[model samples]
Target: MRTKEAGAAMDSEFHVQCPYCGEELDIYLEPDVQGTLIQDCEVCCNPWKVEVWWDGDERSVAVSRGDGSE
Candidate 1:
């Protein structure tokens, strides 16, 4: 994971493909934050519901369409 500093916050970035547009984009996740959020794709401008969490020593991320449904 690549670490970037923004202001006082440090973020770890990972690549995820947009389900709608199939475009890969970088997702910056804060180590202190863990939850689901809606984010827009930079390539297609489509919204995605992203879930981030830490499993033991590894981080896991799940992405889905932003329609508020599973």
Candidate 2:
């Protein structure tokens, strides 16, 4: 992931596959935002649970069903 300056917010981009739709998607999130959030799949309109975490300088992301189930 790379952080970009988006106006006053620092944005980070990640490529993730939609759990339900199985489509690749580019997701933008403010670097300051942490933890899990719900995002709708652009290709399938299904809700997705997006998890963001950082380990030191490394960034990580996980995606699953919006209902918090595998």
Candidate 3:
């Protein structure tokens, strides 16, 4: 994983597979922003709930099925 500064926010990319469609995708994340967001797969049109966080010096992301529920 690598990070770059994009405007006022720090931009990073995370590689993950869609849970529903198993499509590989790259998710752009901001380390300064910590929260869960809904992202749709470009290949399958399935939604995924992505959680972004920091683990010490590295950034981490987790994905789950996005059914519009918290």
Candidate 4:
């Protein structure tokens, strides 16, 4: 799993790069939630998958193209 860039302002927010267009995105995830969800890049408008989860005490996120490649 990839390490998450936590937003200093909120634990629920994370900074991630859009896999399609390389746009930087700030995404919000609910606490104790773990799953992959489809999200569109705010800048490029291309659809992708956002996988959010936690490993032990560390929050992690992985973005993947719509084709499912990371």
CA-lDDT, candidates in order: 0.76, 0.81, 0.76, 0.76
Q: Which ten residues in a row have the lowest lDDT in candidate 2?
A: 2-11
Model with the higher lDDT, candidate 1 or 2: 2
lDDT of 4 by residue, 1-70 (tens): 4345344225677889888887888888776667888878889888778787777776788888876555
The candidate 3 region of ten consecutive residues with least summed lDDT is 2-11
Q: TM-scores, in order shown?
A: 0.73, 0.77, 0.72, 0.71
Q: For model 3, what is the alpha-carbon lDDT of residue 45?
A: 82
Candidate 3 accuracy as lDDT = 0.76
Candidate 2 global TM-score: 0.77
| Order of candidate numbers by lDDT, starting with the best | 2, 3, 1, 4
lDDT of each residue in 3-67, candidate 1, tens digit only: 54343253367678888888888888776667888988888878899888878755677778997
Off by over 4 Å in 3: 1-11, 68-70
lDDT of 2 by residue, 6-37 (tens): 43253378889999968998998876767999
Q: Which candidate would rank higher by lDDT, 3 or 4?
A: 3
lDDT top scorer: 2
